[model samples]
Target chain A: MQLPFSLQPLFDFLGQFTDGPANALIIVIALIKIALIVGGLLQIIPFIILFERKIISWVQDRPGPNRAGPWGLLHGILDGVKLFFKEEITPKGVDKPLYLLAPGLTVAPAFLALCLVPVGPIIQGAHLDALVSFLRLDPSIIGPGGIISEIPLAITNPNIGILYVLAVTSIGVYGITLAGWSSNNKWSLLGGIRASAQMVSYEITLSLSIIGVVLLAGSLNLYNIIDSQAGGFWHWNVMAQPVAFLLFIIAMFAETNRLPFDLAEAEPELTGGFHTEYSSMRFALFFLGEYINMVIVSAMCVTLFLGGYHGLFPLPWEAIATWITNISPSFAGFYPWVIMASYLIGPMVIVPAKVGFFIFLFIFARATLPRLRYDQLMDLGWKRLLPIGLINLVITSGIIAIDLMVTGNGQVELATKWIIGAITLGLFLAWDLLYYSPRRKAQLEKDYRLYPKSAKKGEKPALAS
Target chain B: MLVDFLKGSALALKHMGNFIIGKGNVTLEYPEVKREQPAFFRGRHRLQRYRDGLERCVGCSLCAAVCPSEAIYLEAAENTDENQVSAGERYAEIYQIHLLRCIFCGFCEEACPENAIVMGASYELAMNKRTDFIAEKDDMLDPAEKGFGDYHEYDPYISHVTPESDKSAKGDPWAVKAEH
Candidate 1:
């Protein structure tokens, strides 16, 4: 089923002026998609900031920004305008070139990585042909008279999608490091150095955690990974590789420089961190980069573990279409359009909803947890998450290898995957409940007994422990 | 560790849920709505007067002497038959209180022998300039029509404690009003 209105007709219309491989038409469509996506992302950043404020405020039992526009909807835009009008201060004896370049470096890579993310399912082949027939146009007019193949929802679907995302996102730290060094301020330099170190340390575990998902999916292309997780929620990599999901999420927090891993920008210790010397719109750019990076990370998490755009229970589009057609023959034309609309719009909606959940989790964690001490942040990343990720990767590969040897196929059966997940989860729970909890309680009791009692009603206790 | 994390998060979620249901919000929406201060609340001071439009203060300087911050200053002048100011022999000729030094300790009110000075329920004492903080005699004095401006007039316990015998004493300024 295909929607009656699609870019196919527009592509065909534009194909008339283009010759030689229809590259011009493809470029035109790609440009339009890019414009829409980038524009949408820019527009969404302010609201995401607003959402963070609102959620944090809510967790603190206060009404958040409710005065700007009904429920403070315009608060984010107003903040942007305020930041735009503020004076940009260039401190003395700073590296002006790197200082100026830092904000751009920070923002550009996140947007670049967004290019490879598959926001919606590909619209192609039969759908495009159906669209052509609906428009009563000759198919040969576009792309050598054949259907224009696939119209991917992504801006650009690179074969090395995950690698590109990892590589591009890692460069965001350079912007922070340069911003810090260029500021010629102690706090900024400290923040920048911390960001670089923290990101570098976590990047290892971050990439390692994803290897489990990559192994399970047997593809590094994000779209293929999503495809492998299709059918149901259980098939999602999160269910198959829970340990990886946990490690990935922890590493992701560090990579994003968010709390409890946000030692880079720890306000009490590092002041404003890497952007301490930044002011006005330059500061806003760093903020924009941070939030957009958050969105990108959330999107990647959704694409990898949360089944991308796949809904938990597949919608009965075909059944609904058939039922509608059965109810009235006159509404027969509405059948395919309904299915096609679902096909086009379903993933677009589902993916954001999943991403929004992750974003909310990010905000929730910030509200619930205190910023980790710098050493603790590094310790968690290097000692805890790194080891867990490596172990998870090895165990996953060993299972896959054994499956290959026994069944002549590398794919672990769904039952085997469930059994592994259950065992991992069970072991974690048992350790926490039976061992860790009792030991912690006994330690607390012993500490309480060791605590000195007050000497008397009016006398002071000794200061010595 | 994970369980503890989950528990902490669950507690936050509980608070958030309560906030959404309008249960846990402690914000007072200040400025638009002012809180009602208790009658005993120590605020800015007010000089009292008698029913016949006579000043309650006899220029004894008890409040000035009792002020821990030395915020109060006053001078006394003898009252004559033609120019009677206070019901007593001496009247306060010049009275002032430096609000900037005042700690709102209610000590001055407690030490007033004539029951002439009392703290009023006006805590909005913010002023723009240093000179503006030096409250003049007229500024602290009650209007002539509203006799005996002791804030204890609103306190049921203190109002009931004024001796009934004092009501019959001639020229006694400590006499409680009949309305009370």
Candidate 2:
């Protein structure tokens, strides 16, 4: 039976866009989505500042900057103004050039990481056909591939999309390292060293935990992963990969340098850390840069594992999308709806929901959790999350093997997601029940020191001969 | 074993009182319930205006000169016979106290020969702007009549509280304004 022209037009347009009303609308929505997500981030960063102040104050049981704007928002702005005019103190014996360059280095990566984050529902709207006839191009000379595919709003949507996130985020450490080194102070050196060590140790676990998500998704392209989970509810990674989710969220807090992890400028004691010697606006840059890093991590967490901007859950996407197309012209014309729901709904609804959730989670954690002693932080990274990553992978591989053995294929295996979740919950309880006890932690440290080196237990401790 | 557990329970209850009922040192709900401030309390400072609306400060550089912490910085312009603003020969055209540097010693108050400047009780001096702390005479002055009675209106300068109530009942005459 010949499928009629109206249906044919919709599918044909979608399969290969002719820069029609639909395609143009999709492009415009993508650009608007980009602007909205980025703009929301710029506006949200200040409130995160307020959120941080309020939460910290509450934790300490004191009022924070309450005088500025309603809740000290004006104070944050006032602080910025003060920074601009206040003496830009340059420390003695500091490297004048790199000292200046370092703060921006930490900040720029934050915006870059936000670029791929999906934040709004993809509303079908006016999109310009970016493809155009160029005066210089001879169609004959221009190879088929030489012509650009319609340039998507994303800088690039490569198969290795999230690999870019991992690579770029690690680059943020350089800024802190340089700031610490360039300042030429002992405290800065100590701070830079700790930041480097913490970030480097955790990056491995952070990247590894997300691999569990990547494994579950079975692809690296962020848009494709998001696209695969379009419509109603349950298909998002949170339920499926609970352990990986926990690991990722924890590592994210550490990565962003939110409190407990905010030892970088653990003031009064740190006396401003690496920027202690910094005066005026030069120091203010470092301060804003820290907040920017927090924004980047918060945004990434929203996009990754949380379905970017998917609604609470997606129903069996293929079934729903297929049924709608069959049932009504309601779904007939809008190919972009599937993409737009994620683009529009996820970001407008889900991303903000997730970002708010995580920021609160961050505040709650700071209020509840005392900082890990420096060594303990390093241990959690190298000894704990790293091993857990390997164990998770082994179990995942074993599940894949079982699914292959039982079904004779590795595709779409139903592994024991419940068991994995239980195990993850058990480990978290163990961490809280065991490692979370400060008295126990202190005792353990004392005992650890008391126990002599195993290799040299029998020998007298060797003097520095 | 029962006794040990009971002892632990007793200890826990004691701690529970401390944790739940309150910390032993409960902070007062401030503003509504302020503690009686210390004997030598410094809450807010006011610059005095005379009965004829003249200032008492003579533009003698002594306050700035004598300030050991260099917290006080002053500049003077002579008040000639044609335009006399102060009872003294001079009035301070520019007087600044760098509170950031101030040790809060009453040295500048003591250095005034005319018994002009006195540190008052304004601890509400938090500043988001450094320029705010520069505090021109207008920001600092008492704006009160020279008569003994004007001292304690909620503010002699800008009293939301009656300046009379605002005044400490008694202290050094220079520091405290007396009601006529």
Which candidate leads in DockQ? 1
Per-residue lDDT of A92 in model 2:
80
lDDT of each: 0.80, 0.63
What TM-score goes with each of the models? 0.81, 0.61
lDDT of 2 by residue, B18-104 (tens): 534445424455665655543244444445665567776677878788888887767778889899877766788887777777777
What is the clash count of model 2?
Answer: 44
- Candidate 1's DockQ is 0.56
- TM-score (0 to 1) of chain B for each candidate: 0.72, 0.64
Q: Which lDDT value does model 2 have at A421? A: 52
User: Taking the candidates one at a time, how many backbone clashes does each contain?
Assistant: 1, 44
**DockQ, in order, for the candidates?**
0.56, 0.06
Compare the candidates by TM-score and give the number of the best one.
1
* Cand. 2 TM to true fold: 0.61
lDDT at A382 for candidate 1?
A: 77
